[model samples]
Target: MSVEAKNLTFSYEKETVLRDLSIRVPEGEITVFIGANGCGKSTLLRTMARLIQPEKGAVLLSGKSISELKTKEIAKQLSILPQGPTAPEGLTVEQLVKQGRYPHQSWLKQWSPEDETMVENAMEAAAVTSFRNTPVDDLSGGQRQRAWIAMTLAQGADTLLLDEPTTYLDMAHQIDVLDLLHELNEQEGSTIVMVLHDINLACRYADHLVAMQGKSVFAQGRPEDIVTNDMVKQVFHMNCHIAADPIFDTPMVIPYGKGRKPYGAIAAAEAE
Candidate 1:
C-alpha cells in the first residue's frame, strides 16, 4: 500500500514544525528522510502513520483518508516502530512478538494456528529465535532492535515506518539494522520509510530520498538525482563534496570539517 501526505500543516503548540508539506511514498520501496535536527522528519512519519493528525490536511493510505479507518484497520496495513521503543519489564521476546497479533484477534475470532505460525516465522526471520525465551532487556542493543522488528513483522503489515532505527547503536550495529530493513524491502517487497541522521548511509539504502529544510522538502527523488553539494549546504548547513560510493555507488558525502586533510590537498592549496 502507498502512503501520501497532502498539504499537511502541523505544529507543536504555537510553533509550526511542518508547514504545507506533501509527499507520496512509493510502494514497495525504501524512502529515507534526511535533515538537520527538528526539521519535522519524525513528525511527518508520525502523521503518515496516523499517530498524529495534521492541523490542515489529511494523510491518505492507498488513496483513502486514514481518518476514516479504524485504528485496528490501519494497524493491519501499516506498522510503526518509533525511536527507542521500550518493552514491558521482563517481557520475553516471543511474548512481545505475540502482541503484534492483536489486530488480527477479536471477540468472535480468537487466536488460531496461523497466528502461531506467523509469530514463529517472524522470530525466525528477524533471527531472534535463539533468544525467544530471553527477556527483551537482557539482549544486546542490536538483538533488542531485532526483537522489536520481529514484532512489527508479526503485525503482517505491508508498510513499515521506523523513526531513527539506528539511534544509539554503534557503527556495526547501525549497519546491521539497516541491512535487515534493506533485505525486507528487496526480498518481501515491503514498503519502508525511515528517518535517518546519517546522510551517506541513507543514500546507500534509500530507493527515494526526501531532503527536508525548515518544515519543507528541499528536494525529493532518487538519491543520485537529488543529493547535491548545494542541497547538503542548504539543508544541513554543511559544505560537502558529493561523490559515488566505492561499493554501492550511491552518493557519498564528504563533509569539510575540522579533520586533518591529506598532505596532497594541503600542498594543492599552497600552489593556488
Candidate 2:
C-alpha cells in the first residue's frame, strides 16, 4: 500500500510546521526523510501516519482517505513508532510486544495461535527474543529500541513509519537499528518510511530520499540523483562536498568547518 499527502498543512497552536507539502511514499520500498532540525520532516511523517490531522489537506492510504478508515482497519495496515517511545515502568518486553495484537483481536476472537506465532517471529527478527522476560527499562538503549521495533513488527502491518528511530543511540547502535530495518524491508518487502537526522546513513539505507526545507519537500529521488553539494547547501545552509561512500557507494557529505574553506572557495581564491 502507498501513502500520499495532498497539499498537507499542519500547525501547532499558532505556529505552522508544515505548509502545503505533498509527497508519495512508494510501496514496498524504504524511503527516508532528511533535513535540518525543525524543517518539518517529523511533522510531515506524523501527518502521514495520521497521528496529527492536517489543517488543510488530506493523507491518502492506498488511494483512500485515511480519515475515512476505521481505526482498527488503519492499524491493520500501518504501524508507527514515534520518537522516544516509553513503556510502563515494569512492562516486560513480551508484554509490550503482545500489545500489538490488539488490532487483530476482537471480543469474539481474543487470542489465536497466529498471534503467538507473530509475536515470537517479531521478537526473533528484532533479535530481542532473549530479552522477552526482561523489563524494558532494564535493557540498554539499543536493546530497548529493538524491542520497540519488535512490538511494531508484531503489529503485522505492511507499512512501518518511524520517527528518528536512532535517536539517543551510539554510532554502532544507530547502524544496528538501521541495518535491522533494512533487513526487514529486504526480507519482508515491507514499505518503510523513517525520519533520519544522519544524512549519510539515510543515503546509505534509503531506496528513495525526501529532503525537506522550509516546511516543504525540496527534493525527492534516489539519493545518488538528488543529493549534491548544492542540494546540501540549499537544505542545510552549509558548504559541503558530496563524495561516494567507500562502503555503500552512496552519497557521502563532507562538511566545511568555520575555519576551513570549501575546495571551490579555495580554488576561486587562488584564481583571484
Candidate 3:
C-alpha cells in the first residue's frame, strides 16, 4: 500500500503544474496534501492516482510503475475518489456502490460471494447502508458523497486516494466524513492520500502532511513537525495563530490580521 513518486512532473499545454515533485506515502496511514489554490495539489493527486498521465517521471505503487500494471490489477490495488464524483440521475445508492465491484467481476465471473461481501462491507464502512435504496439524486449532499466513497471502498483496494474529500460540505458534515475516513484507516489499514483545503482539519486528521508550493513540494512530515505558524504564513501567505486542539490534541490554526476593527470596537460592543 506504500506509494512513491519519483521526479513526478505533469504539464497542461505549455504550462507545467508539477515540477520534479517526489514524496513517499507510508502504507496504512492518512497522508494529507495542502497547498494554495493553484499550487498543483490536485494535479499531483491526479498523477499519483494515475488519473492523468504525467509527462515526466513515474508514480510507483509498491515500487512497480503504475503504467505497467493492468487496468483492473491497478484498480484492485488502489482506488481514487476524485473531487465531487458525479453520478447519473435516478441511480440508486446500492446500484452506484455496486459499480465499485467491477474490478473483481468479469463477463464470466460475475457476482460472487466475495463481491457481495465487499459491497456490504463498503456500505458499512461509508455508513450508507440505510440509504442503499435511495436514489442518488434524492440523497443529501453528504449522503451522496458517502455513497461515492462507498463505491470506492467496494473496489476493495488497499490504497484510497481522495481529491478534496470535504468539498461542498458544511462544517458538521466535513468532520463527519473525516471521522469516517479515520475509521477506515484505523480498522482496514488502508493507505489514504487526500487533498484537503482546511489546514487545521488536515493537521488534525492526517498522519502525515505534504505541503506544496507552486510546482513543487514545499515540505512534508508529521503534522506537528511541519504545521507551525511560520510554515502556514510561508505556504499560505497569511498570518495565523497555531495551537493544539483541546479535544483531538492536534494542530489548530487560527487565521488573523484580516479586516481589523477600529480602536475601541470591542468596548463599543459591550457599551451598546
What is the lDDT of every predicted structure here? 0.93, 0.93, 0.89
Per-model TM-score, in order, reads: 0.95, 0.95, 0.93
223 Cα displacement, candidate 3 (Å)? 0.7
Per residue, candidate 2 scores C-alpha lDDT tens digits across 1-272 of 88999999998988989989999998999999999999999888888878889999999988999999999999999999999999999999999999989999998998999999999999999999998999999999999999999999999999999999999999999999999999999999999999999999999999999999988989999999999878998899887777789988999998874467766655465357
Decide which is better by lDDT, 2 or 3: 2
Indicate the residue-level lDDT of 43 in model 2.
89
lDDT of 3 by residue, 81-111 (tens): 9988888988999999999999888888989
| Full-model lDDT, candidate 3 | 0.89
Using lDDT as the yardstick, the better of models 1 and 3 is 1
Q: Per-residue lDDT for 103-158 in model 1, tens only?
A: 99999889999999999999988899999999999999999999999999999999
Clashes of each: 0, 0, 0
* Candidate 2 Cα errors over 4 Å, as ranges: 263-272
Span of ten consecutive residues with least summed lDDT in model 2: 262-271
Model 2: number of backbone collisions: 0
| Residue-level lDDT for 92 in candidate 3 | 94
Candidate 1, after superposition: displacement of residue 136 in Å?
Answer: 0.1
